[model samples]
Target: MTKTQKPLVEDDQVAQYAAEGYFVLEKVIGAEDLELLRGAAQFSIDRLDAAMDAAGVDRIGINAKGKRYFSNMVYQQRPELRRFIFGPIMEQICRRVLGENAFLFWEQYVIKAGDPDTTFAWHQDSGYVHENHTPYLTCWIALDDVTEENGSVYLLPYSRSGIKSYIKHIPIETGDQVCYFGSDPGLPVIVPAGSIVCFSSTVIHRSGANLTDKLRRVYLLQYSPEVIMNGDGTAPHGSYEAFLIDGKVATAVS
Candidate 1:
């Protein structure tokens, strides 16, 4: 797709994302791409488990109801992951929503196994990092058909207006950190495999436990501009490198 071409995201959809802090787009991934991603996810999961075992670290708490298969910076480990992270459609969406110069900040896979008691507390992505970038876009791609019974994500629309105070960071056995905030009844974001749910980093969101037999696998990519400030209002060291997509360097503003 050319830079000037209008991507799949329509004008109304962009408006919705701006107003509600999130939007769902369907059929962004084709069958072949989905199959490839599934394979990559499995590979990442196995590698992560082995690494954790070697380190004698269990990132998932012992009492945690469900398992979280996680890997940070997965694109570097599994080249296939780059297909989704820097894919044409994804780049288009990021450029359209975040701006033409938006760059990828991070990529991860969060697979929630079928566990009835496993639920994520309500929180905002921005809460975890003390970054000056007010808001960036998080593209959550469903690797499987996600439903309410399988721990689909729930988002609170327009919650960015009244930002909540950050609570303590909770460490999980998966070697990942979760930030907690005041709870709220969020709207469930249900989408089929190959679909993407885009939300702002500041949007309040969470996922419930997977009560069904199906697993809920989601690949998340966060995009931001070149700079991110620390909590002390200083530039963070070793700043996150932004990957350019669609010939545009991801930026904080359009």
Candidate 2:
């Protein structure tokens, strides 16, 4: 199918994303690609579990005690991950959403399996690192079908601008505990596999309880302009580092 004829996002979707802070595109990624991502995510999860076992870290949720991450640096952990995250199809959507020449900054995976109590507290991603910088856009790719019964994402419509006023601090053992930035109770956005939900980082969003028997897998990819800074008045480093420059791996700092 041609690029235009292929199942692609519409202008109204983009408008909704900008105004509502999040938009779900139906069947954007095909089944073959979804299987590939599923395999890659499983491998990454296994490796993370092995590493945690070796380190003796508990796989706890953000709200509960013990180590809350099953895996943090999957992009660096698996080179194959870049094949999906940086795929041409995803790039096309990103370009349209953030304008041409949008650079992918980082990626994170949230894997909650079984009866884990590690709930993801409500908070803006920008608050996790840079609280002062623009959060730009985020693409949440689901490897498995996610429903409200399986810990789907909830977001506030049109609450991105008012998020700053609702910022409140809450302490958790995960070292990253913070209340939701926006108080508005927007509609819950539930998407299935082979689909992607895109949202602004400044948007108020949170993952709900995983009530289903199966696992709930999600990949969070954040993109922004080539130039990036921490929102908390700090410099970008480590995972938040800008890696995509001019739509290519940046080899030089200049």
lDDT of 2 at 219: 74
Q: Model 1 reaches what TM-score against the true structure?
A: 0.80
Candidate 2 Cα errors over 4 Å, as ranges: 1-7, 59-70, 159-161, 164-169, 174-176, 181-186, 230-235, 238-254
The reply for model 1, stretches above 4 Å from the true place, is 1-6, 60-66, 159-183, 229-241, 245-254
The total of clashing pairs for model 2 equals 6
User: By lDDT, who's the top model here?
Assistant: 1
Cα lDDT of all candidates, in order? 0.71, 0.65
Candidate 1, residue 40: lDDT: 73
- In candidate 2 the C-alpha lDDT for residue 16 amounts to 83
- How far off is residue 32 in model 1, in Å? 1.6
lDDT of 2 by residue, 91-178 (tens): 6676667764566676766776645464566766665654445557778888788877777787765554455323545766756556
